[model samples]
Target: MTTQIKMTEPQMLQQLLKQGFEHLNQGQIREAADCCQRAIHIKPDLVPAHFLVGLVALEGQDRKTAFQAFNSVTTLQKNHPAAWAQIAKLCMSDGQINLADNALKQALKYPNKDPMVHDLLGTVLSKMGEHKNARKCFQEAVTLQPNHPPYMLNYANNLIYQGELEESESVLEDIIRIQPNSPQAHWSFSGAQKATNTKHIETMQSLVSEKNIHPRSLPFYFYAMGKEYEDLQEWDKAFESFSKGAKARRETVEFDEAHEVATFKHIEDTFTKEWFEQDQKGHSSDAPIFVLGQPRTGTTLVERIITSHSQVHSAGELQQFGLAIRRLSNHQDPRRFSPQLFTEALKLDPQKIGGLYLQTTEKLSGGKPRFVDKLPQNYLMIPLILKALPNAKIVHLTRNPMDACFASYKQLFADAYLHSYDQAEMARHHARYRHLMDVWRERFPGQFFDISYEATTSDLEPNARALIDFLELPWEDTCLHFHEQKTAVSTASSIQVREPAHTRSIGRWKHYEQQLSTMMSTLHEQGVPIDN
Candidate 1:
């Protein structure tokens, strides 16, 4: 008879940790957590157990638990790359970008590197406006896994920001040759360069017509088709494709109009002259200049012009100010900004909020005297910004309502501006935004500067001069030649902003006026003037 030997406690702990990792790989979150807990029970300071626990929490979308568990792993083994990487991801999701940057740096220092970690670090670095470093990280990711579609796609996308459009298209074509089923690759390919013929357009069209296409990928395919058609001046075809794409996208998102309405209404009702005037002293740093408005409304154009000045740098679309508001208000809701969160924020001391915001953005400010925080949605947080950083210059961008709505409608956003997919929803949302702005102007007259997109494009030199004057900066001819700036623009307007300002997009919306009847009618119903 063969004797059965019982495993020792150390061996048993090893078995549990191994089992936890296997379960995690198999997508068994609860089983993985249980195994991790059992391992921790035997050895409380077990780094592997804590790391496994963090992984489980991440899979379950419990960022708080994941952060705590990862912190424990770091405490046990400070040089643990995986743990630090996980912590960086959690911090990024929390809008603690500087902390995320630090954690990512730590993760990158250790030899036990993950390709995904490299890709993530690249994204974080790109967001921080470190284009060259970000490109290296992305290229390294592809090196780690050659011809890997995801990694290759990231590298190709980054090339666009670097203004290497031909190279980007070449890489995208290689991806298509490798993986024919990639809707995202096709979409990126379409937007990489202006289409002069029906080369890739036919390929995308065929992909969409395939019966086996994924439901989730329909929007990407359709949007690609829409863009190419628009480039070819096929307005009817473009409208149809855009409409189908919008419909498909709208179905995938869970957008609630009530939440937005309530949030805007709260801002209008609560944040008034009296509210801000009471206990008004804030952080004294005039380092932050905000360029904000609705997305696709020339915020990037304005930002490029301002940042072209020697005294200023672009902190691309920072979440710091809004995050400061959320943190100071003890916000728990993941909706970013809600009526409840806004209500809670009313009790905050503006100085503390201002201090917190500056602390978070200090790294991104570089050595420049002023840095533009070009987050378009920060328009909603204007009152908080003024109350906290009174000296912060806020430039609001205005575009023709039809052009603005149409611009957003045709674009495929990764995650934001949820109301843009549907014509009626976008129109109504713009109306609400306009209403809030009017109240803000009434409460804080001449506190913020407004620049019209049409006027700026039509009279680039004079408008650029006025913009510079408003910021109290010395006149620089470089500001007028903003398109000549070598800094990478990582916004949707990356391509357009890199070229000389033009009025081509001004009357372009008129081509689709018949197709966008719902948008026009909705704007009329909401009382938004359509100047074009």
Candidate 2:
């Protein structure tokens, strides 16, 4: 009777867990959390509840809370494969590849571990630059779950990375056949098509015209249309399509003042002279390459060109340096900047920060000789990077100020870059970026390379060769064929990257001159040269 009663309790716990999962699936996060917490309280050994809570916390962007929750799960089930895999994902997100690798190794010890474990391990291996091993893991995951969308997408992406365009296209086509209405599948197909330089405009046009298409499909449609027009050298049509796409992105003004205040405080707090001194103390190999300039000033294009070099890889946009500065200045109240706080920020672990950056790049580049970290906003942090890694090379991409400002104002960024919405704010930000770059040039002359977008477009091959020489890379013909390079570019300029290099982007602001007089006046007041 006692044995039977104990078995009944196990079934009851399983039923409760199912109920919690149902709540989770219904978008009731708080309710799901409550149910999971209750289940865990009832059965301290319930690993799933703990995992659910951790996942919920992570979804809420509460990393500390999520970590604590996952830590509890691991403590209770030391050898649990799922718990280890969860921890590995968290570590990967935190840029702790080594820890994630170890966690994944532990997870593979379990018999018949989830396919996601293999997928995640593959991602971590990819991040660590272990491409061969990552490919094996992805292959294993696909074999284990042949129809999984994520596994298919990731494996296809890997093939794209390896320049296997036909194979990637086939895989994406399979995805489209299986899930014809999937916006992401179409987007990936477009990317593969762009890479192969095959005409895909008609396919995209058909998708756009489908009744009841996904809202998320709009951006890609307009982006694809823009690319199509650009390929045909229809500059006005391309600009219009891009404008429509940017506007279609939904905008909300909640917490506008708070956001502005926080950003202003962050800028004031992090860019102090004292903060600069603190970041200078420790550095090692000077292999840092910065791709910086105004957003839409062709920084991404520059990155794509440089990264095409055999020795160079892309690190995407790194927020860590800025995050490090902000962390160091955390002792200061946001209400105002203090000299004392500035002095304390000066005492931060520059060596530690530099070490963290090196650690991150080492993983991302997979032992490539050089890598490009092209975060346009990094223009503001160039002084700190130079101080920390004096051997680092900075490439500053310059566009006509009006063109840059107009481009920025007309595009929509994800929530993080809120300043671009208003033309005046966009102009001000561009001026500030220019001023800062000038200051950096004065302070560290030979450390920087200034490339004009006009020069690059007017004479693509020569400028590209010069850039290669500047980076000390053996010239590759492929660098000159950058537009034909098919990699996943997650930026507003994705459409532009698909086409060959051209000078049509120049003087684009003139068409909207009447719409941009305020921005022009602001630029004039700031002494920015706009006539060109």
Candidate 3:
């Protein structure tokens, strides 16, 4: 028979926290959360326990648990800046920017001078399209901790987002000088500049091989290495680097292929053409001009061009639509909001839905006649959008199928978009996306203006003129000079759009044909309309 040993209260709490962290690191979210909750039971006022649980819940996409845990930490420790910062982070991730802003302000009032708080605040401000204020926050963070690479990197990113590419390049150079081993700095720098020579290729290759580098950092460095190789026209090497980067990212990020497939099927089944043909009335606000398509398409370029007009403002990918849908369904997590829930929302007053959309966007409009919503993923909500904003102008952008898929595969997304890591998954998703668009087109004839990326780039003047005509607005010279505008572009195409219109990305996927064979075959199998 074994004898039972009794442990002290403090010892038990410490052991619980340690076990929770071990589970969390191993990706056992449920076990980690249980351990953390047990630790919290042992000591109700334990800040670390609450915070750890919050992080675990966040990883598992349980927004309610994470929000409550973080909120509890703030309540338990009134002056806890870190807790407030975590709250702000969760809010931002949920697309609650105003709440995040308020939380960041509270975090700043605390005595702790962690540059991280200020850095995060800067990111929030950027998300709100407040670039000037964001620049100030970034500058303050860099001032408070000049040697911190993350703060400096954020400062550099803010600069780049606001079209200050040269200054951003300077800041990135300083970061590289200060911390030579920082893969993030190198990766961001590559995005900001095009290389003429392969001088840094050998150094990047060696750094990627170094076992001392952090696992999280390798993906960024690998992508940067791929960009360099692509610039040099070394196709095989570029494919190798990009493949490694995508694989590295897939290891840690959680994406559900099954959920994605189900979501698409739910959408198709629920929003039948007959459902749209039913009598429904929406708020008569034609103030929104939605520009949507798959990522890496010309959506950003189109939005910039349209918002360049005097009567239009750019809202820069607002989450208002997603948030509105969540509120309507009373859902905790937007991703988990089921098709049945959406069907239930369809029975609600369309005016209320449309009103919420306008109220959320109008504040950002500053009384402009039109505001452009450049959310690419908004394509998924096309049916709901048409029902809510019947008078809204929808501008749908398209690109060559292979180029679009390849472009998405090459970049490292900050949040979700799990299918981007695998070529066939990406292609299949694109097929579904295209099919949905086709359904929408049949449901609402003469409702959307289609703009092909290749066609627009091939004949900029005429195509832009036609788009302006579609909007019932006269063309302005400034529309052609959209890149010269001072407004911030928060998308991945920020750097590329700052340059003049070009055909460089037109057939980008052709260079990696061998590597993307799986994608090409999948697209063909799924009937994704590959003209090029």
Candidate 4:
């Protein structure tokens, strides 16, 4: 037989690119990324190679690499709408909404039929406080790709945000019809609080126990089942479902309790009362009304009320201050409150850090005099916040420990909520949170207004008025009807906040008190006062 002729470089590149796409589709992310890199080496200007590399990098969670690769695609082809679309997505994730908007506009300027670009543009607009424009983008995306579940879901979310609940429910049902096996579609519909269909619930329950289904989908399936059980008032079954959901979620992320302990210890030691008493200058802005607490502790409820006031803007869960800490620490970890970082944050110029946060938020506020930053974990950064924005009002939300922690445990966050995965860990974190709050009270006397969920829900108007007075806002009846406000809440409380304030959530932890024994023991060991 004649000797086999070696394939040419172009042939090799084509073969590699095809292999990369195949591997990418098959969930072999590293292998796909490697193939793309090899293709890029053989043909540096290959647009498909660069695009695949960006996609693989994004899937592998290397956003920096993805940004560069996608940017490269644009350089090679100026009218590349797909590249611009990805650039917009990456920019949004990096908290660059303005840039994302510009990128999306560029993407739409081209003759592109891609629904994802329109979908992403919708999300960017929503985050920028452009609800009407966002809805339009979502509508266009859904029209272009009627069968795509994600497009339908995004459109449904926008519809819900605009108080079109019936329309939103219809779209969600359409999603279930199109993709009957889609766990996310079923899970999303459960949040509408209208899951009366026994067939759908049974289908989701069966999906949860199916070993053939995706492992990542298990968390959502379990949580969806939990929601159904809770709706039916099967308390024990509900708790069991929620526990499985939390366990499945925890398996996906590595959260070290030791690391968390070390981090909190660092915060306690670094930001003392004596530290605040020092002659330090900070950026002064009455614009910031900080609502700080553990997650699910009525921070969102209070935010809804506060933002309903005409003068206040709702900048949901800002990461700017946390970003500032990361800037000082020189650590890339988005969670910047660790021992390795806090000391460095303490050493930085407070005014500069404070100024950056205000500037970033003001752009999002649309000239509103006051804006709410309802980042619950900002409790850990209270000292940093106080030292940076001295004139800002702080609203500390307190909930019954069991209610707060258990509520958090039941949620499957879009991102990592490491502490919420385990009850004992959650209790430990709550104790640390309470300790820090006490420290804040001791150091900055009369500077904080503590709002209790139980107290507020028990007597709504009186506490609502107190909260308004604390913000130095003139009383408006709008605050009393926060649910009537058109602005959509993007939190776990999204559905709950749509209804009038009620005490149904009060003493909710009693339903599963037996299951929470480990958490209760941990809280007691840490000197937290459990209720009678």
Candidate 5:
């Protein structure tokens, strides 16, 4: 008779883990969790089992359980690379950036061979505004997996943000070669450089002409084609590509107009002038300088001007203030900014909220006396910001409504500006934003400094002087030389901001007046003025 053997507990545990991982990959969360839990029960300190559990929890959006499971994995096996990477991701999302940085440092102590771990680690660092460090991690990932287009793309995108355009273009070229049909690679490659000829345009056109192109990728190809046409001065072809791209992209995301309406109404209804005047104490710090307004309205340009000062450092697009308010309010709504969340945020103590925000944001400040938090969407949080940091300086960048709307509509963002893909929705949102800002100006006269993009770009010196004066800082010649600064810009305006101030982008919407009738008519109906 042939010898028969029953599998040992350790071997059985390995089999369970394999099944768990397969189920996780298949999106069978409960099945994966059951397998992991069984493995854990058999060997309570099984690190891989716990790590798998953490991954499943993350997929299910149970961050608490995910953190616990990851912590368990780290406890069982210190210097576990993937566990630390996931932990750092959670910490970063919670606005505990210093903790995330610490976690990353721990992860880097060991040799991590996994490309995904490096990519995850790099993304957290990117969100923390440590773009240089993030670039290193992305490079490591790219080196580990040269054939993977996503890995190479991550490296290239960071290169662009860091203003390494030549390298970005080379890397993108490689990505295109590796995957000849990648829509994203084409889009990114088009953005990284201005078109000199129609050669690459014809290449992208061939790929997009394939009837089998996926719906999810249609936007990228179309946007790339649109940009090339725009550069070539073929306005009609550009608009056609832009509209088709926008329509395809719009189908993939969700945006509720009613939610935005209520959220704007809630802010105006609650944060009255009298409420701000109330002696409800807030964190007393004068280190924050907020550069905010609608996206594509010169917010980044102004932030660059402000941070060109020796005393100011740029903290790119912080989520801390909103996270602080949300955490302290004890409301666990999933949406970033919502009517429910905003209403609940009113219950928070300004002092506590402000204290948490500064504490989390402290690590991003580069020993500067003041720091610029250049988040355009922060215009929505102006009332809270003033209440929380009374001495904070707010600069609102204004642009012609049509120009601003058109600019956003043309560009493809990475996960934000949801309404930009639809002309009517984009116009209505802009109108609402303008109305709320007017209310804020009336409620808190002289609380903020407003500068128009047109005026600032046309008369750089006087506007720059006034801006410097608003912050009570002595004027410096450096503010006028922002384009020459060595700081890496991580926004849509990255490439353009590298050049001296110019009014070339002004009245750009006029080029598309025929194509943008829906947007202009919507703005008119909403009573939003087209002029700055």
Candidate 6:
């Protein structure tokens, strides 16, 4: 006598869903999507299957498909917190702040929302410049899930942005204690320590060597070492460490004569006035105040002075301009610019571009009226910027080319910038940059202003006055006292920005005369004035 086994279709669907979820947890999105699709085929009403499918689509960067999938989940399960959170993240990426905010608000309406929902909301708020609100959300997230390192790290990041170094240190310490092997936590912790205590420099160096930290971490570690050496006025060691970091990540050398000729050819072939005009038409006529030049060229100092005025706000080097250009290109290769591409770019809605920029920046600087985008590399993008925002003012900060190149070559930038380390490459790139600027100046005379770093540092008052007038802002005494400004300095020149203006940095490249001999000759041949 054998008993017949009976299984319902619903039971099979449930089993598949379980298996799908397990695969999802193991990071097998494709496999999980297949299982979930099978489950949905068996039980078409299964909302979780739709949700899982949506997540898998997102992993594949198919936003439209993901949106449809998530929309299906919401149709089936109206109050799904996870779905709402996903919508918020999508909106944030698209630069849709109000929509992101509304979605997160809806997510919170559901009971027992995941701590991650709060964390995402916090990131959105931080980008919007609502630091206080962002801090509250991050704090709540950490409290709800204390063991989560990411949440703690984000909370610490907020603290660092607010210029609250001690508080950030405390948060980082807790994170390190919870997960001792976290390289990021240690690196960030080291950064905070470097800011507050010059004495901790030796300790950081020791840790870097002993831990055999990741290569990516080398730049920051060396940067910290350079800062310490600079603080001690140990110029040789500072130069060596800075050079090491720069050399490790150099993409190309700027000063090389051969590289210079190649770069000149590329610029002539690639960038043109018409190309800029098209880019300009894509953005609003309202030009942003661009502060650009070589790194350590007093651009940051100028920004600090200008931002100290009542009307101006300091926005750190904007990653957005590069992002905006990429978006406007619409996947068209920048190396292959054509009239059709220009026409397509020109037709982009200015209001949309401006609104997106304002939305993204509004969250970063706490809703300041006049913000600064102090990215040094914006020098290369000047044409695009001028075209996009015709009403925008351009401040071209100039330092002695030799000094600027030397400073660039010796610094360990966080991101890989090609020409910084190689002397010949650095010289060539610098020449190309100058040539482009000359063309831009000839094209748009009054719109661009050149402020020498020497003038700005040697005589702070006149330069400050000139800068204020250029920005069309009322002169404030505090602009002269930018060192006293209590804002968070995020760049490598952070410590330098905290002090009064000085000429000590000017012409400091002469000390490495032997090493920079080739660069010097290249600068002279390019007709760049070199005193040394």
Which candidate should be chosen as best, given TM-score against the real structure? Answer: 5
List the candidate 2 regions with Cα displacement exceeding 4 Å.
1-7, 108-113, 125-143, 146-151, 155-163, 173-181, 191-241, 250-284, 304-316, 323-345, 368-370, 402-416, 420-425, 460-527
- TM-score (C-alpha, index-matched) for candidate 2: 0.76
What's the lDDT for residue 532 in model 6? 25
1-532, model 6: which lDDT tens digit per residue? 9997777887788778888878878878888889988988877878988988888888777887788887788788879877877887777666555677777787778875478767877876665556667888899889889878999998988887666778998988888778765556665766565444455566556656865666665666566566556657677877776766666454223323554355455545455656655533434434357899778778888888888887777767766665554465564443322334334544565545554565555655545557788878777666556655666778888888888988777766554355676776777677777777787777667778899889889998988898888878777899989988776666756656777999988878887777688888888777767762
Ranking by TM-score: 5, 4, 1, 3, 2, 6
**What tens digits encode model 2's per-residue C-alpha lDDT throughout 1-532?**
3554444767777877788778777777788788887788789878888888887787777777888888888898877776687777777765566677778788778765477778877776665556567778888888999977878888877676655668878988887777665555666566555433325556666777889876766765675566556556566776676666655543332224444444444545556456454525667665678898888889888888987777778777655565455455555344222344434545666666676677655666636788888778777566567666666788989889998887776554555455565566667767766776666666656777899998998888889998888887799988977777655554556556766888887997887677678789988888888974
Q: What is the lDDT ranking, best to worst?
A: 5, 1, 3, 4, 6, 2
Weakest 10 consecutive residues of candidate 3 by summed lDDT: 332-341
Please, what is the TM-score per model? 0.92, 0.76, 0.86, 0.93, 0.94, 0.74
Q: Would you list the clashing residue pairs of candidate 5?
A: none
Better of 4 and 5 by lDDT: 5
Candidate 6 to native Cα RMSD, angstroms = 5.7
Q: How well does candidate 3 match the true structure in TM-score terms?
A: 0.86
> Candidate 1: where are CA atoms >4 Å away?
1-52
Candidate 3 per-residue lDDT over residues 427-493, each given as its tens digit: 9888888888887888778888999999988888888999999988878988888878888888888
lDDT of model 2 at residue 344?
52
* Index of the highest-lDDT prediction: 5
What lDDT would each prediction earn against the true structure? 0.88, 0.70, 0.84, 0.83, 0.90, 0.71
- What are the per-residue Cα lDDT tens digits for candidate 1 across 1-532? 9999999999999999999999999999989999999989889999989988887998998888989999999999999877887787778767787788889889888885478767877776777778888899889888888899998998998998878889999999999999998999999888888989887778888888889887889999899999999999999999999999999999899789998898888878888788877966888888899999999989999998999999998888889887887888777788877888778778888899999999988878867999999989999889888888988899999999999999999999988999999999999999998888888998999999999999999999989999999999999998888888777878888788889999999968899989889999999999998984
Pairs that clash in candidate 4: none
Model 1, residue 124: C-alpha shift (Å): 2.4
Q: Is candidate 3 or candidate 4 better by TM-score?
A: 4
lDDT of 3 at 71: 94
Model 5 agreement with the true structure over 215-281: per-residue lDDT tens digits: 8888998899899888888889889999988998998877777878888888788889888898888
Model 6 misplaced regions, further than 4 Å:
1-87, 94-113, 195-287, 294-296, 315-369, 375-377, 402-427, 484-499, 502-532
